[model samples]
Target: MKGKVLSLGAAALLAGGALLLTGTANQSNAQDLLGVSFIDNVKPYLEFRPRYEYVDQEKTGKKDANALTIRTKIGVNIGTVLGVQGLSATLEAIDVSALIDQYDPQRTKYETVKDPANTRITQAYLAYKYSNFVFIAGRKYVAIDDHRFIGTVNWRQMPQSLGVVAVAGKPIQGLDFLLAGVYERKGIVDSLNKDWKMDKMPIVLDVNYQVVPQALRLKGFAYLLTDIHNTYGIKASGKIGLGNGVTVSYLGEYAKQTDPYQKDNVATKPDIDTDYYRLKVGASAMGFFGNVMYTYFGNAGGKDAGFSTPLATLHKFDGWADVMLSGAAKGFYYGMKEWCISAGYKNPVIGKLMIAYLKFDSDKDPGFGKSIGSEVDLLYAKKLTKRLSFLAKAAYYNADNGYCISECNNKEDALGKNDVTKYWLQLDYKY
Candidate 1:
């Protein structure tokens, strides 16, 4: 009975198009086009990136988590395919490895890390575009504006994508539409039951139009979701620019999800309705920096208006540590919520350095007097060259309760002194 679960919707389409992308798919098209391809309209480019990290996971029994990742991408955008074409492929192949023997000599006291690395083909797809429309088939990428909902699994050693056929068209001015028919079959190993009865059928429909394009900078959106897990939601966002580089942005969402039933047609008791909203405003002076953000989650999880489903993108608003996707994937998080205020200074005049700071606060659980969590973060990234860089980050969390979840938890140290520290460095290359 212990196995994995995969969701396959009726139309069977999986998401890979990025509207708000994280770091990985930055160089999607072809800026590195060579000779004739640039002139003949067949653009070709390549990228090679290598990342190395060392983490000290206090609860894993081991003293460190060290590994190396090598990412390679070679793609071509052909102007004419069989005498007719306009499309491209971004990433071709990638591999990850753990160099267990290469322990840092400066830190002789630490233990060796394990080899938990993996390898796989990340992206391989073809695209076709005509004046006001775009079409993609095979394995590609997807991220919806800030990764609020579905995004490419770029954080994994071997992320996931679908065998998809999608289309984008502007049906009218100020209005656009997207539709796709995705492949639904799963590999036997990935399909928990190996029955392949098509476990997921997701039909996504989203539209955003400039509501106030002139005097006020604002927009409205409607998202319709249907399938394996029956549900739908509405979201809207707007921004106002105060004079002199200052601005405010607000976002809100409400989703009502029914239950995923077993064969008996029995509905899971107390289906939940969830709502989340965030309002943040900040100012910019050159690249020197500033920001303030506040987010709130509903109080109850099992009933209506509370917790959100797992694998759903919450990092759309906050930073991506993926620390929140824990729990029953259906339970409520205690406390009102939290706020984050961050600011930073990029490369200094005297030294080549970048540093940032984050201040956090804890909110008391709905009806209780006890606080949940509070923390601080210090991050720095330095460029060795335009193509290579290194990063060092630290986090400090002060929590009074047992902060435990399925992915990451603060349960190992029940003494409440569950403070944590983490740091890492990496080298990158892009072409």
Candidate 2:
């Protein structure tokens, strides 16, 4: 988790042909472009997203952050390469421009807004298919399941990607598997400090089987992050139909983390062992859906260790306000427990609207109070056209009376001690 950041932004290349390729290249013409036999299919895509974000933190004394940013992504997907039937390639570039940069991209004077002004090659990958297996290499988005353990942080203006060599396959009718070795991870921080390189490439393995087509599915995964920790887990999820247009869904997952394979002979190596659990139940009918969930992250026996998902999309879990994000990375002294309730409605004309409430507590009592915090989040998204969309989101966090501060054994727990509120309005256009 601690390593040099790969600076891919140094040589920012803008592919001007992306615009032209998206418009005029048909199959007949693409097949014989520039005397090449197998440019068989060329599809170019572009996305422009302009967003405004406001953040207000009560205890942080610094000025509130107002970040207005725009994200542009342009890419081309080549279905066939050099007349090879199963060979394909994808190239993408992303740029984030800030109009109002009043937040901390790299520990600035203002509050923290993860959006930074920079450009990088977001995705560049080559894939080849043979039989039931597909081999992938280069840099691209690497996500597993729900993105809880390993994922692309797609919520931010600058998403996360991995430099990896991977193989994926569906060898049977109801089974799927992926094995990847990740050498570099590009996070959503500033481009200069975004990519993380480790002494050894992390290994990820995932296997899933549909026990019953749409009724039950089982999954097993192991993630070995060098110098961090190895996490292995099992998950079972399923959906059931009760009546006409009504369905219920459920999920249960459990994981354990242990010390990873380490070779950086430091004075003192890390000691980590923890447990994690997540349980959820949900139901949906007639354009309405609701869910109740419980999640637990073990403390790794407190002090300087804990279970954390270094490669996860942290923003999607814990709380929308990120009240538990930083602290969760180091593991709390008393561990952390979260209870969440969410409801949403979707309509073709009215779009989709959702609201979520989350409560955080400690697994064990500290001298102060077990109460951690609570958060409320609201979101509305609508598609304006075939290739355009609008989204609005807000989160409010109210801190509790757990003031152990610097004098406490676990200062990292104070990451959520300050009350914070944030709002975002965004527009996305894609072609």
Among these predictions, the greatest lDDT belongs to 2
Score residue 295 of candidate 2 by CA lDDT.
94
Please provide, for model 1 over 248-279, each residue's C-alpha lDDT reduced to its tens digit, 9 standing for 90 to 100.
55555554454433212223334445455556
Off by over 4 Å in 1: 1-41, 87-91, 101-116, 153-160, 180-200, 213-231, 238-256, 260-270, 303-306, 309-322, 327-336, 347-370, 382-386, 404-417
Across residues 122-205, which tens digit of lDDT does each residue of candidate 2 receive? Answer: 888899999999999999998888898988889999999999899999999999999998777778874423333545677899
- Count clashing residue pairs per candidate: 25, 0
Please, what is the TM-score per model? 0.67, 0.89
Local distance difference test, each candidate:
0.44, 0.80
Give me the displacement of residue 397 in model 2, in angstroms. 0.2
The most accurate candidate by TM-score is: 2
Model 1 has a clash total of 25
Residue 116 lDDT (model 1): 33
lDDT of 1 at 153: 45
